[model samples]
Target chain A: MNIRVADDLTHAVGCIDVTHVSISLGEEAEAFEAVSDLSFAVTPGEFVCILGPSGCGKSTLLGAVAGHLKIGGGQLTVDGKPVLGPSPDRGIVFQQHTLFPWKRVRDNVAFGPKMRGVGKQERRRAADQILQLVGLSGFEHFYPSQLSGGMQQRVEIARVLINRPRVLLMDEPFGALDAQTRNMMQEVLLDIWTEIPTTTVFVTHDIDEALFLADRIVVMSARPGRIVEDLRLPFARPRVSDLVTDVEFVRLKRHVRGLLRQPEKAPQLARLDPLGVQEA
Target chain B: MKVIRCLIRGCSVLSCVALWQLASSLHANLGVITFRNVPPPTEVVESALALLKSPKLLAHVGSSLWRVFAGYGAAAVAGVAFGFAIGRSRAAGDLLLPPLELLRPIPAVAWIPLSILIFPSSELSMIFITFIGALFPIILNTIHGVANVDRRLVASARSLGGTSTAILFEVVLPAAAPSIVTGLAIGMGTSWFCLVTAEMISGQFGIGYYTWEAYTLQNYADIIVGMLIIGVLGMGSSWLLTTFGQALMPWRRAVETR
Candidate 1:
């Protein structure tokens, strides 16, 4: 399906070939702006994390990318096309685990391709493949309510991944998980991302989580949220969790923490500025 | 525990029958409240057995079942349809629901006079009364169900490439299934109620008509039999509906398990 161009806001000319390019939220009259002059891009197969304090509209930005929210300013494009509304190409994983409770696990995973008019046999095959990838092959017929929180989130991830989206947007998908499960899920997510290598925009509050999974971490500031620090990680792919204790990892973690603590308002004039903060 | 509970239930029913029999026996001797018109348990049981043997009893049951099912089926279809329209669309709700809201407060029994005049035949009038009786609960609960479906589900469905029609059928309908089932259960009950009332008020052959006719003929035993048959039918139908509802709601079974 062709991605239709959305009417531009007249404030800025649109950018091309960028996943999640400069989507802002809120009208000028709103009590407070949710996101302001927020600009970012995700290269194909790149894993980017948007880390911020709570209520900083990181999720909102992710929502815009997923086409669940309308951008009030600038534009968001995927593959050189503006996101007029929600499309199958941009899949979203909500923190609440929005698996259709009535459907069995496999059917939930198969829903996207079914909606996209794929034949039942093909979608079923795809669903089984993805469910196996998520380690939920044995749970094909279990309802969402019968699963644990962690298992349900796994099903949620599998459901989105089955769509083979251009960019997978996740809003703190492991925030509700226990510490151990969260670590495990982080690993599983990385494994899945590596296998498919779709462009992904993961929104999270945990600095360690951002540091662990992101090839590039965009640290956002609170209220009228804008990207404050855009740092690239040099950690090798298939990096182990033990790297959190690595000397360079520790130094970069501390540095990112310091940047987040600085309370620097994202200068609008310096827009398109990447902050260029890389940890060697 | 299961055996003990069953034994207790049996004892309870036995005691109720014994008390009823005792009350009937004492009525004439004590010169107290008129249990004189009420038949003893044995006489009622005999009448029930005789009625079961008779062809006329089957006709009464058949007619009542037909009226109840026809009215209730129409109510179910129309209620869910209108309910979804009202719940999902603002314009439909604004235009359609206000008059329904106004009419809703008037009892179904109260519509008997208007229904008789509106429909050409008494059978249609009786069905109409039952329709009115069943309509409200079904429509209201369905509206509540459709209106309260998790918004995030709709958003998620859209992101997954669901069109508006697909979202309604796949997401909204299933999410609202529990509430819709509750509505159907309640609608069955109200339909039975109004069916009996309409059957009693109007002419011919039904369990309700049988009971009312027995009253006029002073056949107290047959009256009790008719009442018992109606009770059994209502209980049986509602039980079936509840079982159907449970089958439709497998997700609820998981929630109920804990």
Candidate 2:
């Protein structure tokens, strides 16, 4: 895959325009294409969820967008600039809480600004503010190991948000938490997003989570992942947990599940036995 | 439970001492055992008390400590530095590790002859032996630690716009610290062993020298005192190393407690 930016193409003002992006992994001579011609656009302040079954390469796609992984083909641009490598302009949260185990919660949150050469006093204050925003007000001096899994995730979220990134890429940030904790984290995420909305591309395997959190759900096909459907969710903001019982939520879940259940779309998935990609 | 555990430990130590003292007394009276050289706890204590008054005891301790710290401190810094290079860089590992691996299996005691020839003084040779003993474990553990750092953590740091230097300082070093500390603790034990061995074989001063002198003089009680000093010192240094390691990593302590 190759990326070529033509002179005539205009930047979409404030958006993540992923144009036929593909990613390949493994050796040079026999590289396996994991994602293929996945095209989509995320408008400014839009919350988009990329949902797929395991081995679908949704995380790879997100990794490419975050500039953590190199795109093998096509162009991926954020607000017009091509994503060649990682920048503070885009922040990512992983399934595992990636806060530095050595750092205190406040220091972990302050890391991005610290890297960008922010002064000690200023970064600490900014970190405290973000920590408070993530509802971890009293956990400033606590190390990651002392906190529960849910609290660690909160620290991870605060770490990313403190950067004030234009695009927030989350690969199942709450996936490792318990069911109850996952629910609480989702609400907390929504509250934070409402307060300071950024263009978000959240990748997950959970259909209910996708439906609940996304402005648009981008469902991907299996191996050699491509876009299967891009359904717009019309759920109003300030959505409550009670909305899960709404008929529309269940209908959307069933539709996405049906799309995921089709085995014919990716026959190569069967060959991946014992080596299944951990999507969530 | 804690008090009971401590009491059990105290009793275990006392029992061993009591058994040794009884055997010594019985052997002295009946001549049942051929182990005449074995000093009783009383004799050892008396010898230790007598030795404590001699100024040479302080000199021996001071010299041994100086050599051990000089050699071990140098080894620790050099080992960690080389370990990071070999672990993180393929070129460095390929170029340097094979030779190190070949040299590592050779025991520190075996290097005494060559070290004596290479260095100007036996003092340096003794320190060299201690250095060799400490270096291998520290380097090997550090290499393992740095190489095994979680890829996800590095990736996350890179995504957060971390430079290579920043990532190394902030993520890789800290993540590898637990393993490095384990190596350091192991290295400290090995350092003491090699130091004593080297001192016994060829040394003008040290605890090992004092012990060797006592053996030549047929002062079995003084020999026992020397042995006990070495044992206590070895145990104490290792404990200090572990405590230092724990202080550096607050997260590991929390997890351990949990």
Residue B102 lDDT in model 1?
98
Best by DockQ: 2
Q: How many collisions per candidate?
A: 0, 0
Model 1: docking quality category: acceptable
Best by TM-score: 2
lDDT by residue (tens digit), candidate 2, A1-280: 0112342335322389989888876577966887888888889878999898766888878778777678878999988889888777788888878888889899999988888888999999999998989899999988888899999988998888787787888888888889999999999999999887777889898998999999999998778777889999989989999989999999988889998886465454422211113322
**How does model 1 score by TM-score?**
0.91
- Candidate 1: interface RMSD equals 4.3
Worst 10 residues of 1 chain B by lDDT: B25-34
lDDT of each: 0.83, 0.86
- lDDT for B198 in candidate 1 is 88
Tens digit per residue, CA lDDT, model 2, B52-138: 999988999999999999999999999999999999999999999999989988998899899999999999999999999999999
DockQ of 2: 0.55
Poorest 10 consecutive residues by lDDT, candidate 2 chain B: B27-36
